[model samples]
Target: MVWPPSLRQLEFGDGFTVRIATLKGPPSLQQLWIGHWCDEHIARVGWPMSLQQVFFSGNFDQPIAGVAWPTSLRVLSFGEKFNQPIAEVMWPASLQQLSFGGSFNWPITGVVWPVSLEELSFGDGFNQPIAGVVWPASLRQLSFGNRFNSPIARVMWPVYLQELSFGDAFNQSIAEVVWPASLRQLSLGRWYDQPISGSIFGVVWPASLRQLSFWCRFDQAVAEVVWPASLRHLSFGVCFNQPITTVAWPASLQQLSFGDRFHQPIAE
Candidate 1:
């Protein structure tokens, strides 16, 4: 079947098998989606060379050890049912953003990550240890999945990381973590209610931090905590009913949001 020469995006909802040496995908295709029960060996050869974004969704749990990832691919997403081991997979060098779906929960200590990756996120099933993992230098935004509660106190976070988010299960101590100087955004998980001021040496606040979020169950007191000088946005989730009257609001704060349960009055 002949496809339109100008076709730039394509999606195959049914099972698709890329025949060896006879792939007939769109020449200028920039986006491709392979959905539901796709043949795991679809990578027998290679995808369209011009592909910039690719998505694989539903039941693709096969090993991708020697798959030839598109060299020009910039963004790749794996959907909910994917849960494959990727320790031996070669990631595309051109990839900048990647996201894993709900079922992915592999230990990535031995995985070779792409050097140019800027954004990476995991889904709900991830809960692996990551203390000694060396993150990519080019990573700017990173987030853990819902089940990730790994101790990251000793993890060497990327020096240039600007944004970091944790999953709902994260409740680790941060007494020894030295926040990266380049960090701009941070999000604490739903169950994170760590006492920052109670730590022997209070958690070091990154001077460049701009945005901070506390998820559903956070109700920690911030009265004695030192606020960052550059913080502009701060938010508390649904369960925050803490008294903020004695808390020192950052001078640089531009927006502040409180949860529905917050009954504390702010002094002008």
Candidate 2:
């Protein structure tokens, strides 16, 4: 039920928990309270006051549109209905995991990820990926668009990136990617690219990389592709038009799956 007053602070037991029954205008308290109510449920929540995770979702009109601010918050996600100018919002410095899955008309231009940010996800709507967004030093997992040709070649990934997943747009040339030595798990595949280049740079495969999947359509032969020695789990799809002749299996590779025809197999 909607709160009768626009500014009413519902105090819960101690801190770490709160339920705004009906906030009329703004919180009269100085600690943590709503300051303004401009066509917004709570344009911004989680001031320096007390609150761990804040979730704001409504059809209010504001710059933030729908956002929550928790100084110590580790995860921050914008609702799919959020279409306002989110670029104006300053992400919390304590954020570790962030997901932008909203189908908004705006693109996340030049926003630096906080040093605390570790995992980041971008929905399909993020058009024209940023050429260079510094990944957080602590970042490990990154999942973004996978269909068509999403420009990931230029984005400056964190040196510590480990688990990376592409949605469907996997048409990137391996040559364009500068894999970090700290990388562990790399997953790339899908109906995304019609013709992928097999000659893409062959990563020596970091010793950290344990789980890896190479699936997708390639105009060339699979034999041209080189598998990293550290890869443990590998999955290959009908990405290669021609058959693969030699399949170099890494000693660490324990699980392998070859879907459909891959030209020639490990030379029998």
- TM values, all candidates: 0.92, 0.71
The digit string of per-residue lDDT tens for model 2 on 1-268 reads 3323342243322232223423332322222222122234454443533333443332223465344564666655554455566555677787787776445446556555678888887666555555566567899888765432456657676888888887665566555666777888877746543323344454344567788766665334445545667778877666544555464567888997775665454555
At residue 155, candidate 1 shows an lDDT of: 85
lDDT value, candidate 1, whole model: 0.85
Best model per TM-score: 1
After best superposition, candidate 1 residue 46: deviation in angstroms? Answer: 2.6
**CA lDDT, every model vs. true structure:** 0.85, 0.57
Candidate 2 at residue 122, lDDT?
66
lDDT of 1 by residue, 214-254 (tens): 88888877878898999999999988887777888899999
